[model samples]
Every structure is written in structure tokens, then in C-alpha cells.
Target: MAEKTDDKGQTGQEFPGFDPKSVEAYVVKDPQALAMNFARALENLGKAASEWLGPRERGEIGDSVADPMTDLVKTLSKVTEYWISDPKRTLEAQTLLFSSYIGIWTRTLNQFSGQYSGQPVASETDTLPKDKRFADDDWMKNPFFALLRQLYLVTASWADKLVNEAEGLDEHTRHKAAFYVKQVTAALSPANFALTNPEVYRETVASNGANLVAGMKMFAEDIAAGGGDLRLRHTDATKFAIGRNMALTPGKVVAQSEVCEVIQYEPSTETVLKRPLLICPPWINKFYILDLNPQKSFIKWCVDQGHTVFVISWVNPDERHAKKDWESYMREGIDFALTTVEKATGERQVNAIGYCVGGTLLAATLAYHAQKKNSRIASATFLTTQVDFTHAGDLKVFVDEEQIAAMEKQMNAVGYLDGSKMATAFNMLRASELIWPYVVSNYLKGKEPMPFDLLYWNSDSTRMGAANHAYYLRNCYLNNTLSKGEMKLAGKTISLKDIKIPVYNLATREDHIAPPKSVFLGSSLFGGPVDFVLTGSGHIAGVVNPPDKQKYQYWTGGKAEGQYEDWLRGAEENRGSWWPHWHAWAEAKDDERVPARKPGGKALNAIADAPGTYVLERV
Candidate 1:
């Protein structure tokens, strides 16, 4: 048998075992420390079990997990029915799996016999997906792990195909099935398990199982922190504190309401835009995402650009605020912020911006204002906002009748949806990046994740009032009422077309929460002039991208008509952040200037420091 060298020059002889150098890399030196840590890890594991069981023992948690999962099972059943119901299709699926498995098995045998090509045999084309999970050398060097990786990828791809080609299912059902398939496949990936994952296997062996001990200890701590639920930690929570290191832009909470605190940021310039800027951030997460740090803070950037910034920091709602709905948010939250901004700036009209769900609420408010002929907001900007749900992306899969009903029942039980629930949902949108990577690093590698301001802000989840969430899911996602001229607000049917304010609608190209297509389609619903700009990156990074970072590009001069892809083709791509483009567009709307005002003006007095107590309230 001839030895084969891979692209990296490692020979076929390295196929079966952990190379000495590889094993030596993770070797633990202190036996005594390892033993002590192992014992501590075991103790923590026991504590974790105790924490998990304590709630069940006291009947604090319900055993009704299946109630919500029932919809998922039913949704997935449609795909199963499509395949299994037809004998020919079922056989085709089985044959596809068996053929792929046979190929992998043959390649494994060839490698073991030293009669293989150096190129990977992980997929049919000898090319693997660009997945970091299988980046370890052992994944391709070791026959066993290679076989597992290939088999898993083939099966997962087949599952996706099944959903895609399935017949007799409605579009919604098909989308839900496909989403569930991705989730199921992601969870069952070989990299998720210690024995199956080559890297974890090496770490465990070299550390004499010390890695497992540390991982278990961390797992216990995470479960305990989640109050018996596993709140997967993405970053070192202890390293971040609101207003201390994160959300560090100077400001003061000048006005407080039942639903929100209006923070008037200290102006950075001697003179500021006469029309104060009011930001409405989604209650689903803390407003601090926009003000994560001075470097990344959009609020700080706006202030520096001579805008008197006022932000609405929504409360982490509980049972008391569960009854508050969208109208409640409009009147008490946005309207309250507008009034506060007026008092603080001595301005009647202001430029307004909304992010994610916050943008949705702002759009509705604009429509309501249009109905009332209220021109308080001279210009409106929506960041990654969706007015139409036709192409709302994967999130719509979770908004069907059964799922929303289940969510309503759960939220009704507590008067508000737990912040963790929403956080988990958002994480699932990019589980491959958001959920699994952290799971592997934190619990399997026994490493504390790096402290990141953006991730810390992401982890600081906020509860949604029962009425508010239900109304949002139904009106925006389910009914698509907001885009249609049918959504009733403040006892009157309002339309986006009637809102004649100059609009700067910003959509991220890679946004999952609000798909670019949905945002583009939504632009047509507005009667006023809309400057629809598309920028690079996903939901958070795309919006928070600062010009100083010189990261990501933005597109302009494209009409938000026809397909998003079509518009994208004609759009001019410019280097760097979209902030400057937006700043130019907004300043064009109304660039009047006045002397910078204090945190609280002649009427309203300061309530607290910037980032307000409402944002500080944790779930």
C-alpha cells in the first residue's frame, strides 16, 4: 500500500490515531490540580442536578413542555407525511441515505488501507461545507470522525431536500418543517457530543477527563443562573455592567413613565440640530444595544453629529404591565418620549428612529399620527424594520396559529413572555453561529467566552408585556395588517401611505429578523418619499457598524420597487458604514440648529443618570 499525503502534507499513516504531537499539545502537567478540579467539577455537577430538580420537586415548574412542542411535532409531521405517504418517495429517500453511507464507508476503508487520495471524501464532490465545527485536523485525518462528519452532512442535506421537495403542503407548513429540520439536524450534529466530536475527544483524553469536569462545573453554574433553566452564556456576564463599561455615553433620564424612561443624552457639541432625535428601541431587548460603547454607540455618534438625542428605554415588564398593548406603548412610550424631548429641547417636531420591533411600533405610530394629522415627527427612520410579513423570513414559521396560541397561553400564565424565551428564539435564527458555538466552547471546552459588549447587550434580554407581544405577532406577523391600511390604532384605522413624512428606511442585506425583501416590499406601502438604503452584515452589526471601524459597505440610489435583488443590482455600493449616508439624508430633512440644551430643559427635571433604571431592571 502506498502512503498518500493530504493537501497539508500529513500522510495516510496519521489516519487512525491521535498523532503524538497532537496529544502532547493538550497534556495536563499538574496532576494534583487536575484531580482537585475534577472533584470540584463533580461536586458542581451534583449541584446542577439539584438546581434542575428543585423546581420540579416544589412544583414551581410545569411538566407541560410537550404542550408547546406539540405544534412543532405536528408541523414536522406534514413533511413526514409527504415522504412516507408515497412508497416511491420513501424508497428514494432511503436509497439516497444508503448510497451516501456506502460511499463514506468505502472511503474510510480506502484510507485505512493506505490506498486513498489525499483529497477529502467527506462529501460526494470531496468538498465539505465551510463549517468551523469540523475544522479540526482530526476530522479529516481520522477515518472514524471523517465517516461521521460525511454521514451527518449527507443526512442533514437529504432532510433539507425532503422538506424542499415535499408535496401537498402549504407554504407556511413547508417553511416550518424546513426550520424544524435545520434545528433538529443542528442539535444532532456530531460536534455536539463529546465522544463524536474529534476536538472534544482530544481535549478530554489529553486532560485526563479534566475538561469534562470543568465543563460540567460551568454547566451547573449556567443552569443555576437560569433558575433551573439552561440560560446558555455567550459572554462573561460579570465583565459587563450597564452604564459602567457598556452604554457609556453620558446622558440623564429626564422623564419616566409606566412603560419607558426617556433619556436625554448630554449633547456632544456646543450647538445641536433644532429637531431633537427620538430613538424608539424594541422592548424585546435593552435599548443599550445602540449605545453599547462609545465606539459603537449610534446614540453617541448622533450626538456628535449635532443632534440632541432622546431614547426610549422600555421597562422589563412583569404581571403588572402584561395588559399593556401596542396602543399602550404608542401613547405611554413613544408619545411620552416625544413630549419629553419637546420639554428638554424646546422643539415641537423631532427626527425619529426605530429599531427592529421598535421600528414596527414606530411605523404604526406614524400611521396613527397621520390619521390624527399630527406632524410632531418631521422625519421617520426605520432600522431593519418590517411592515409586511409576506417575506418576513424564518420568524414567520414561529408565528402560525398554533404556535401563537401556545405562546399566548404561556404569556397569559405569567402576564408577560419571559425574556429568555425571546432570546432563545432569536438565537435559533442563527443557531449555528449563536447557540452551538457557545455550547461547544463554554460547556465542552470549559472556557469562559471572551467579554464582548455586543454579546453582553444581547444576553441582557427583556420581558415582553403579554398584550404587547400578542398584538405584535398577530398584527404584524400573522395578519400583515400594518402594511395593508387595515391595522387599527387608537380606535381608528390607519395606513402607512397616509404618513407623508420623509422616511429613511434602512435595511440590512443579511438581516434575518426583518428580511431585506420584506423591508423593500414595505417601502412601497408608504405614501411619502422613502430613501431605502441597504447595508452589509446582519441585524445588529449592520446597524451598529461605526464609520471609524471601516467595516461593511452600504448601498444607495436604488428604488425600493420590484424585487429586492433587482433593486440591489442597480444600487451603488459605497465603502464603510451607512451612518454617514443616513446622517446626510436626515440632516437634509431638517438641519436647523440651536444652542445645545441641558439634560432636562426648563420644564422637565432629571430623573436619573443615562441608561435609566428601567433598562437596569433585569428579568
Candidate 2:
């Protein structure tokens, strides 16, 4: 018989052909190593406490303490006032919640009594939903625990209804209340507590509470190492090294500037497309994400498909780059990159692609160039990017006037917005998936983190300039000026509508950073034909999906100018990577295939090997 496997991937019984003793033999832990780990953790805790108590870090502590409480107070005041004014409606909501829980218990009881054979309640999304926190735990399957889970879900639903129905609250205020409500509700999940969680309790007992000690040690170490706020090191950092195991694409640094370095990848095909492809990755991360490994590298895939690929490796900005604004990124970064591509490939017109914030900047550059009547770009592609920030997802919660002002002060103090701050915000967006799970595994259960390439990339973050970050938050996010044609760069007002080139847009169905609807809206802004493809998985996984993986599916035939739902209604689902579709579209745009060109020509000579110097700059 086949062995049963739990969610954590541990089999209930050993494989029929394998010896259980062999597995146990390999799973040895040294007491001396554990003692050393403990010692290091203690040292880190003292260092962290000293830093936290310091005058420079005290301001940050104050903001951290104030912001959450401020939002909580506002939410509570509004909720209380609404409840007081509509006691009848509030009571009705409570009644509905009670009814829902009672109905759940009735069904559960029926199943227990063998009267029902229906499946247990599950979340609508295959992935865990934000509010349905108790869905994954097997303990929750027990009749008693199941009822508790149902009660929590019902209460959460009722809270959301109350927050939504609260009259006299502004949209922003309502969103804040809903955000806080979700946080509070999510914390109350059965999975979070050892007493409530069977798995954690089992592990705790099995380890004789050594797991708790290990967890505390790990937590202290991370805190000392300055990643405590984010919590849990998701990847074994010692196992993988950059430019070795990770980011291993072969290329040469053909061009360089203060803000960016253009890496022209080695051609994989003897013949290549006439219009070379230039990739502008977000400055918020290392460019190596696009070229993570041989099998997963999009740049390698593009090259293999007979296209000369070039990627911008952004500088890890410091105080020296503090004065650099969005315009600097445009003029010195994208503009310079275009010149470098032309110089190297001898192609006056090149195809450009951008991911995340890079796509936002690319859109702006296209409009900026259009204003100058410079038609250098043949086509444009956006990967999980947002030009319209009006509905830019939960991230909008951190883009308010007060938040922006506070951010500016913090950045001013530091010269750049620290990568950790950005990492913390992004983690909060999926706290259940990213943050709390790590907290549970690393702290509560005292397990070592599994090595993951993607999580490592996620942790490998980059700083943002004070001026640039401020401008982006205030203009693009706060005012929603980019889509409105109110955003200006180099003395000219920019608009996404002026981007008349053939556009290919990709959005992930489960992306928290760039919602599919928000990404699809960029299609309407473009003056040219738009091909928007919605793929399964979250932001990074959705884009990095290579054909060989065949892990997730994507949908085609979506209209860029229509509502996301309408597009979804008529779209055709395909069972593999979107790379082939993208490559076919790109090839159609180019004139003809020609003899492959080398990395550099006369003006733009190859400076250094691929995955260049700037990528090595870690702050």
C-alpha cells in the first residue's frame, strides 16, 4: 500500500523499498552546535536591544508603536459608533453569524453520525484565503475543532460585514477598519496557538519542549541579525551563494552608469531576431531574479528562442544615490539602456520589457520618448506591473498622506528607504503565508528553515532613494497621476495612453502586489493593440514559470481594454508556460531573423562578464 503523506510532506509510513533507519541515521543533531547557536542568538539579542534603544532607532520604534495603535483606535471608534447607532442591525448581523455557525455544526454533526457523505467545508480559493486561517490544520477536522473553525470563520465574515456596512465612514477609513479587522481575526486562528494546534502541540511534546527553546534561539538570532521584524529565515542562506548556485546566467556587462548596468546576455542561437530585447527589472530587487538559474532563467529562454537579450542590473542605492529621482532613473537608466542596446545590437528599434516598478518606469519612458517624437522602441511588454495605482491592492494602505510624510522623514534620516522596511510591508500583505508560518515553524516548532531559491530572492532586497520613493508614492500611488497624464518627467507631462506600440501584458491571478484587474487597466491606457494574459500562481511564480515546469496554467484571448471579469469569461486556458505565447507574439513584431550579434560593437564594448558588478552590490 502507498504511504499517506501529511501537509508537511512527512510520510505516515516509510517507503516499502526504503529503510526507516537510514533516514534516521542522516537526521543527526549535535548538542555542541545547538549550544553555539544558542550563544550566537543571545549575543544577537543584546546587540538588537542596544540598537533599538539607541536614539537613531528610537524614532522608528515610535512610528512602529504609534501607526498600528492609531489605525486600531480609528477602526474601533468607527465600529463602536456604527454599532451604537444601529443596535438592531448589529444584533441582526450577530444573529446571522450565530445561524451560520449553528448550520455548520448541524452539517458536521450529520457527517459525524454518518447521515452526510459530503466533503468538509473548504475555502473558495485553492490557496488559503486571508480569513479562513483554520482550513489547513487536520486538527480542525475533528468535530469540536471543526465547529470552532466554523465559528471563527462566521465571526470573521460578520466583522467584515459590519466594517463594510458601517455608515458615515470614508472609503480610506473603511479600508483601514477592514485591514485591522482582518489582522485581529487572523491572529485568533486555531493554528496560531499550541493549545489549539494539534501539530504544534505534538511537535512540542515530541521535542520535550526543546523545539520551543530552539525557536526562541532562532528568533533571537534573526532579531540580532536585523531581520526580526520580518521573522524567520525562509532559506538556508549558507547553502546557496549568488553567481554560483543562484543567478547563474552567462552574459557580459556591455554598458554601465551610476544608477544601472546593462548586461547583454550571450546569444544561445547562431541566428537571432533583428529587434533585440531589453529587460528593465525593478530596482527594488536584484536583476538576477529574471536569470535565477539555467533552467528557470527567462533571459536564457529568450536567448534560446533566437533573441539577443539585455537586462538592466540596478545599483543597490546608498547615500551617494540619495539625490537620484524617478527622472534620473528614466534619463540615466532606461534612456541610457536604449542607447546601449542600439549601440551594441545595431538595432535602432528594440523591444522592451519591464517587471513590477520597472514596467511602471518603462511605461513612463515610452510616453516621455513619444513626447519627444523618439520612436526607438518597437514593442513593449509588462510583467505584473501597474500603471494605474488607484486599485493597486492592499499596498494602498501604506500610501496615505500621513504614511508618506512619515516615510519621507524616515528616508531623510537614512538617505534611502531601507530594503528591510519594504520587505516588511510586502510580507504583511501575505502574513499568513510568509510571516506567521515561519514564526510557527522556526519559533514554536523549532525546525530549521528549508532551502528555497525563490524565498532567498525575496529576502535579497534592494534600497530605494528618498527622492525616488517619495515621488513614486506621492505621484503614482497617492495622487494616481501617472494614469491621469498629470505625472511629469524632464519638463513634459507623461501619459500611458501615448504608448502606441504593440503591448503584451501579463498579470497573475493571485498577485497581491499587482492585482490582475489593476494590471488589466493598463491595457485600456495603451493606444495600441494589447494582449493581456492572466496566469495562475502569485507574482514571482507566475512569471518565472518555464515550460519544462508545467506547474501552472495561463489564460489567453483577454481584451486589455475590458473588465477583468469580461476578459476571463472569454479567455482560453492553456496548460503550460506563457513564454511560448510571448515569444510568438514578439517574433511577429520583428522584421526577420538574422545572424546573431555579439555582446558589444565599437562604442558599447563588453565591460565584464554577465550578471555584472552592480548586481553584486548588496547594502
Candidate 3:
């Protein structure tokens, strides 16, 4: 890729002094740091051991262990009750399951006798969407293994049906039960077993036990490292440095607060839009998702499109920030950034965009401003954000009273919700895609993970303040108070309906974190003209899509009538990235063109180059 010039027309090849090799070497061989980490690990283990003996912690542990059993028993009872009430329907389901098993067995017998030639049965919603797992193993393709896999899938499907369709259960109860059933069934898949998974067996034989030995070493090292939880390293740490490769957007940090720092990018166009663009990114992770590389950087694209862009790089909170809450985030984070943007750009109104949780915060901030009768926001855009959490998909399974209390206990003990814990929860949502693949590759096959930018960013997580997380989960996820106008922040109860700015919302088709339908429901809450777009691909890939790649198609012309299916049906499919469409929409809302501005302005001076200090802070 060609090197782009900054606002001052200065060409920079790389981050000034980033040395990946030195950083990697220090991380691997730093004796003092290693000793400190080991000491911390021991202390943490000691505390955990003591806590296990305490009454409160014991009760928490007991509840944790008993909750699953309680759910299982409740589901079984519901299923039994339904069967007793409706024998005919119950018999039909049982008969279908039995027939499915018998059919698979018959197919296997016929295949052995050279009488069967059809393909093996597979679930449309199989956890492993990709088929490369068993493609190279002839044994896996054989009728025996195929039959085994088919039986597992059919059984899992039936279990899920039983849980979801059980009578005398509320919708929430059914969803929770179905989620647990799916999780249990996924864990018990034939693919996870050594005898059934031909590929793992092949890998074991080929490595001659070396893979297992290496996996053991990795596991031990992780346990002693004090990071807490097992994190699969997706790339060699020595291969890439943060500012140099991951967050390479050319800009400068113009303003900083306790919560966030604002980065103002160098204008890539001679004439820029009169209204500046400010981005509010999620604090749960680094803000570089929109600025991964030149080819994929949305920030660069916006700069090149003649819009002066400003992005908020959030501080990765630690124990010191444990008391920070939702109000702090709005007042010290988004509100601070908005003020900085207005002062730096000398623009009365600015266009703003938010991603994921940041979008949630942005909506709240806009509402807060509306309550104060402020109108600094010209237009608003939300990317993969959920304002209404009624149907937040599998993540809702973890938002109930018990789970939230458990999470609170964990966070309270540590002062913050450990990023690894959050990462694990997300990985579980797509275990077949994210977690197990890494487990098999790194452990069973003894292979090094590929150095992919996206995966690298995924692994680089940020801790969440205990107070902030508790407030967010309880108010937003648990109570569904944000859309209901009952969420109190900064001593004010803000409502989404009060914000009347024109809105552009984008949702991914396969986003498991923030389901498309959940994101679409935001339209109904916004008291403004809403243009909703549905793009192809999952959460991260969908939002990072650039038009030059021409990879995924997006659908436009959807009116968010609080129904995802209806919106999708009426939407028109358009090829290429939704970035161009967003740019056009943003430009239409912007003022007339003006001479481009530099990174620093008269009021707000530049503190440091972009991908600034806040992003470099390690928790």
C-alpha cells in the first residue's frame, strides 16, 4: 500500500520508534516482570482458595453449580408436563426422532453393503458452519463416522426443539432453556471426541505426542502468567507492533480526558465537508477496529472522502477506574469528545457515529443532550448497536438475575470485569467458529496461529469497570430500561425518543453479539427519520468492509418497523460496501464544502500523533 500524507503533507513510513522484536523479547525473557507476574498469580490463587472457604463465596460457587441443574430439571419438567398434556404431539415428535435415528442406521448398513449412495444428513444450523474440519480425513467421510455425526445432530436438534417448544413456560424461560440445551449439545458433539474426530486422531499420530506435550506446556505457562483464564494466542507477538501495524491511521491526539482521548486525523482531501465527523467507539476494546490498515481503515476512507474525522480512543480501565459508571462514560467520554470536536473544528453541529456499545452510549448521550435542549448533533449513525435488548440473542442467556449477580461478584473481587472473562463469554457464543478451531489448531495440531490483523485485535481486549459493567448490564440488558426511558444517568432519566436527529443504522446479517433484529428495534425508539441498512457478514467483518474490496453486498431501503424479517424482505440488495452509501448520507447532512483543516486547531493543540497514548495503555 502507498503511504498517505498527513495534514501537513508530510509522508510517514511507519510509527516513529515501534520495535516489535524488542517488545517481544522483553515479554518473553524479562526476569523481573516474570517474577512479579508469578507472585501476583500466587497471590490471586491464595485469595481464590481462601474465598472458596468463605460462606459468601461458597454460596456463590454452590449457586453456580446448581443453576445449570435447576435449569435442566425445569426444562425436563416442562417437557414432561407438555408430553402429559399433549400425548399426540409428544408422540409425533418422539416418533420423528426415532425415525431419524433408524433412518441413519439403515443408511449406514446399506452403505456397508454397497447399496447406499446418498450424502450424509447434516443440520442446517450446525455449529461448525465451515466444512474444512473433516475434508482431509477419509475415515471421517466413511459411513460409520457420518452416521455418528448425523445421529448427534439429530439428537441435538430434537433436544433443542423439546426445550424451545415446551408448554407452560414463559418465552424468557424457553429461550434460556434452549440456549443451555444448545450449549450442552454443542459440547457433546461427536466432532469434539478423539475417537470420532478423525482429524485430531491423525494429528496425534503425526505429531507422535509432541502436540500434547506442547499443549501442556502452553497451559501451564498460561496458568502461571496471572492473566486469569486461558487465552489462545492467535498470532506471534513479535510479528506485529500496535501503532505500526494494527492502528496505523495518520492523525494526532488533540484532546484527552480521564475516560477517553480524541484523535483528529489529517485531512486526505483539499476541500473537506464543513461539518466534522466524530466517532464514539466501544471502550470494552481498543478503538482501532475502524483503523486497522490503509486498505481497510474506515477513518482513512472518511478523511479521503473530504471529511475531517475525529475518533475517541478510550482508556483501558483498571482498578483505579473501578468506580466509573455509565454517567461517567457519557460525561467524561462522549460528551468530552463532542466538546473537543466542536472547539477544534469550530463547527456548531457535527455528525457522529458509534459502534456496538459505543453506539448505546452515543444514544444515551444524545438523549442527555436533548433533555438539556442542546442541538449540537447534526446527524447520527449507529453501527451494529443494540438500543433495545429484548432479543439480544444468546448473550441474553447471561443477563438474568443470577448470572448478573455472579458477574458482579467476580467483578467486585477484581475491581473490574476481566477482559478474558468477557472474551470467553463472547467466544462461547460462537465456540464452533472461534474457540474450538483455535483449541484444535493450537493444541491438537501443535500449529502456530496465523498473524491476522482482525484476530490480533480480537485478542487485544480491555477491562471493564465493575460499576460501569454492573450498571450497563442491569439497566440496559436486564431491565431493558434504555428504550423504556427509565435509565438514569448523570442525574437525568434520558429517553431515546427525545433525540430527533436524522439517523443511519447499519446491522450485520450474522452478528451474534448484537443481532440484526435487536439493532433494528432501535429505529422504533428513535424519534427521527431512520434509514436502516443490513449488510452481509458478521459483526466485525461487516462493519470493516471497504467498497474497493467489493466483497460483501448490503441491503438498503428497509424501514425498521420493529420486525427484522419484514425489513429484510422489503430491503433492496446492493453490491459492495455500505461505506459509500453512508458517506453519501453523511455528506447530504453536512454543510457546504470548505478548505481542509489541519490536525490541530487554534483552541485545542495536538498532544501526540494518532493511535495515541490511551490506546497504548496496557491493563
Candidate 4:
């Protein structure tokens, strides 16, 4: 044991070095002593919260050993004692405080959330049958869940060791240690604040928007004695969509396929598109992301652009569709969209635009087609999408063989990944962004939240087929073989190098979910001519960006020569929205402008509305 020196009376003194092997970034002295003491003052925070609001009665908080809020209170007490004794060594303590709040939030999220759209937590979907029985299987072994569990164990072990070993650690060191605690704790109980400290929750989630909407939801739930929110808390609507596997008819949209139905908006088209544009949206979300409303819908924009657009709205997966894998998605879901588009436009080759996971599936679809030598695709666009799974980020933290087995056990019982669980995982990824805002308003402020169009849109989540999710995780993230040109799908090694089609990959600069690095991986993965685009804003806004939102400014650095590495090295930096640049590129590649043909054919079928039926759910 090294004897550490501490000259505390003098505020300004050289920090003594501690054993580096014992801690993750050992400090010479506590730099944040005062701050740690401040956090220590919050020692009564738990009791205060308990008395003012209420004690947590949930399983994780009330039952689990890794419960964060309880741990926070304990750590706060220790810090307070240390502060009262010698406030100089408070950094580690302050970090512990940080851990308390963060851990509470993360753990709470883990406890409440049900399932994600397609992403798995811990099951081998390949061997399991697809259906509700798949989800019912024991998912404790899920890779994601395992990672989550390990996150808890590792954090606790490290935190405990740091506190036990360090001596004369200033407030700053204590705070740092505590912060480590918060990070792991938050990873487990991100939504804990919602139950323990709702005030903070609402503010974080609300953002620039007010809490009127969230409040309205609570009021509806209260009035109905828990009918959930009348307006829907982004999750309910999405979950409902997942369970039902059908688009919601919120009385706002009616699906139709008539030449007159589509042409009514266009008085007379001057030029016809050489290739039809087919839109493929992820089944996990409502198709409206492609063609949301007139202001944001890409489908509407494409249709108005004189390009015949056909959008696919996937049926929600249920117990019956649990066994349906990527094969089903390609053969049934996406193939249906392709056929519908081909029939509508009387064109064989068409442009395919896919968003998020839909983009992944689209690439797979084209692979299936290319393997069969049926190349009807002229050009393809991927928005904030990653074909290569090497850098998928926090989502990867949940993937591994052990976790996969655990999840397989659960999904095997249920037949499909649970939508609630999927939603929970995403929420954990962005706990502060998604959960906190609701906490502050409804619980602390006792106020209502404004109905934010964006939050409302975010709350909508969906489910995925068992085999499809299993195939994606195993082939993409865990294997890291997708970008390496080593992914086998539908009885064939799906090689990105084989497809010689023109590829356009778009990514957001500040995106957390789909980081630019991951999205840019497509350039190298695809052997075809490639164009890498850098967009402004986040994952959703970056892709959903209609020509000019002006909210963000984009810079293009990827070279247009189509080689990903060469583009990375030589990619020039430009200012302003790349939408114009994209349009120009599309126009140049487009064969020629011909006479506008009459809209519709024998394939035209009338259905109801814009957002389609799958996305609009009230529960």
C-alpha cells in the first residue's frame, strides 16, 4: 500500500499521487471538493423524495440488489459523512452521487420497458418459431439483457472497489467515483427518476416543447382510471401498432391506388420518370416517416416530383408471424411493395429509398434479387442507415452469444420480440431525452405538457419477427461480417460487393443512434458505385429533412468517386444543405426527361388515407 500525502488545510497544494492500478483515473488530489460536498448536501434527497413524493414500490427499486435510488441514498449518506469529516477529498464522492441519480434512471428504464421493434435482448431467433410464444420465453439470457446485467455488476464492483481502496481522496475524486456509479446505474434504471423524481423526467423529455401533452395523457389515464393517455404517449400508439400489425386509421388518412387519386394533386406533368421510385419503410415504425404529412412526407414529395412513388406499409408481426424471418420480409413484405410499385408505374427498374432498419432490409432485398439475377433497381438510397454492423454503438453492448441464448429462451416462448422491451431499450439509449421531460412536468410541476409533434411521433414503436431480428443481430453486429462482405441471408452469402448498383448513403452529423461513422460504412461495404452524404441534425431529422428545414447546416466531405476510403480521405467540406446536391446528382444520373404518361393502370386499387393504417393506434 502506497502512503498517500494530503495537505488539506491549505486550499492550494500539490496533489499526492495514489495507486493507479487501483482506480480508473486516480487523482493526485480532490479538485472538486466543494462540489462533492454540495452533492453530499443532497444526502437527505432520498428521504426528502420519499417523504415529499412517495417510496418506490416497484420490483427493481424495491427488490433488486442493484437498485439505483436506494444506492444513491446510501452513497449520498457516505459522501455526507466524508464531507463533514474532511471535505477536501470529495471528487470520488461526487462521482458516486452522479452514479446514484444515473443508476436510478437506467435501472428504472430496464424494469419498465417491454420490448423493441426488432432488436433482440437475449434469444437465438433462428431456431425459435415466430409468434407470441417466442416473446414468452425466458429472456434473461438475451445478449442485451446480459450486457445490461453485466453493466450492473461491473459498475457495482468498480464503484465498491474505488470507495474501499482510496484514502484521503478529495471531493473531486469522490465525485468522479460517484459519477462512475451513476453511469452504470443510469444504464440500468434510466426511468427511475420518473418514479422517484418525476419532475426531472418531464423536463428532459419535454425539451423546447411544453408538458401539456404529457399532462393530458395523465389526465386521461386518471379519468379512465388508467386507460393510458387519450392522446397516446408515443409508446402506446407505437406499441399498439406493433400488437395490431395494421396501420392506424386516425381518421386522418385513407389509402388509395387510383391514377386519379394520385394525379388529382398534379394538374399536368411535363416529364415522366425513366425509373419508378419505390419506398420501403421499417415495419417497426409507421410508414408515415417516409410520407408523414404534406410538410414532412417524402412519399408526397416524390409523387409531386413526377416520379411514380409506391410505399410499403408492413403488417405488424404477431404470434402467427414469429417464425417469419428475413426470408418472409423479402418474399412477402418488401416483395409486395415492389410488385405494387411495378404494377402501378408500368416500369421494371425503380429507385428504392429506405430509412433506418428499412434501409438494411432494402439492401438485403436487393441482395436477394441480385442473387436471383432479378435486378429491377436502378438506384438505391439509405438514410441514416448502416449495412455494416461494426460500429452500431450502444446497441452492440447488448449483443453477444450468452445474451443471445437467454433472449432465445424467451422469444422461443413468445414467438416475437416484445414491443415494450424494444421501446425500453431505445429509451435507455436516450433516457434524458425521452424520459426526463415527462417526469418533471407530471410529477414535480404537477403541470401539463404540450403535445409535441416530434415527441408524439417518437412514442410510436413497433415489433419485429423473431427470425428476422435473430438474423440481423447475428449477421450484423455480433459477427461484424456484414461490412466485411460475409453475411449469408436466405440460403446464400449476401455480399454487398456483388451489387453494382448506384448507392447513395446519407448520415447525420450529431446523430447518437445512427452515428455518421456507422452510416458511412456503407461506402466501403458496397462494391457498387457509391456516394456518401453527410447531413445536418440528428438521425431522424437528418433523413426526414425536406429540402430546407434551415434548422441544420450540412457539410459534404465524401468524394463522389464512389470509393469509401478514397472518399473519406479526399471528401471536401462544403456548407449548407446537401439536399440540392443530392437532387443534382439524381438528375444527372437519371437517363432523360420523357413525356409524362397517364397515371395508374389495371393494378391501381383504392384504399383509405396518407399515413396508412399500420401507424395510427390509440392504446
Whose lDDT is greatest here?
Answer: 1
Score every model by TM-score: 0.94, 0.85, 0.83, 0.62
The sequence of per-residue lDDT tens digits that candidate 1 reaches over residues 503-565 is 999999899988888899999999899999999999999999999999999999756888888
In candidate 3, position 51 carries an lDDT of 41
Model 1 CA deviation exceeding 4 Å by range? 1-43, 64-68, 121-123
lDDT of each: 0.86, 0.79, 0.78, 0.55
Ranking by lDDT: 1, 2, 3, 4
The 10-residue segment with the lowest total lDDT in model 2: 17-26
Off by over 4 Å in 3: 1-98, 121-140, 222-228
**Root-mean-square deviation (CA) per prediction:** 4.0, 8.1, 14.7, 17.0
What range of 10 consecutive residues in model 3 has the weakest lDDT sum? Answer: 17-26
Clash totals in order: 0, 1, 0, 131
Model 3: per-residue lDDT, tens digit, 1-619?
A: 2245789989853423222332221123444554554455455545534544454444532333224456556656766677667779878888978987887777676655556543443532343233554454343346556676767877987887777666778877777777777677777776666556666555545444455555545544444443333566766655777788777878899999888899999887889999989999998889898988889999899999998899999889888888989999988888888788888878878899999999999999999999999898889999999999988888887777877887788777768877776777787788777867676666555567778888878878889998999999999889999999998978898999998999999999999989998998877899989999999999999999999999899999756895689778878999999999999898777559999998867887889988899888764
- For candidate 4, write residues 1-619 as lDDT tens digits: 3333456644321212222232222222343552453344244333333332332332211222223344346545564565456565566565764664465345334433432322332432332223221121122222233333334444555455655556566543354345545455544442233322222333423331223333433534432321221122433333323213332212121133211112112213577566766667666666655544556655555555666555666665666777888777776666665665566556777788788888888887787678889878878888788887656765664566655665666666667666655665666566545655444445333364564445555555566667777877787767866677666767788777777898888888777667777777666767688887877788777767676454566656644445445555565665555666766666666856566544344566445443444444422
Q: What's the lDDT for residue 11 in model 3?
A: 81
Higher-lDDT candidate of 2 and 4: 2
- Local error of candidate 4 at residue 558 (angstroms): 4.3
Error of 4 at 124 (Å): 48
TM-score of 4: 0.62
Residue 327 miss distance in model 3 (angstroms): 1.0
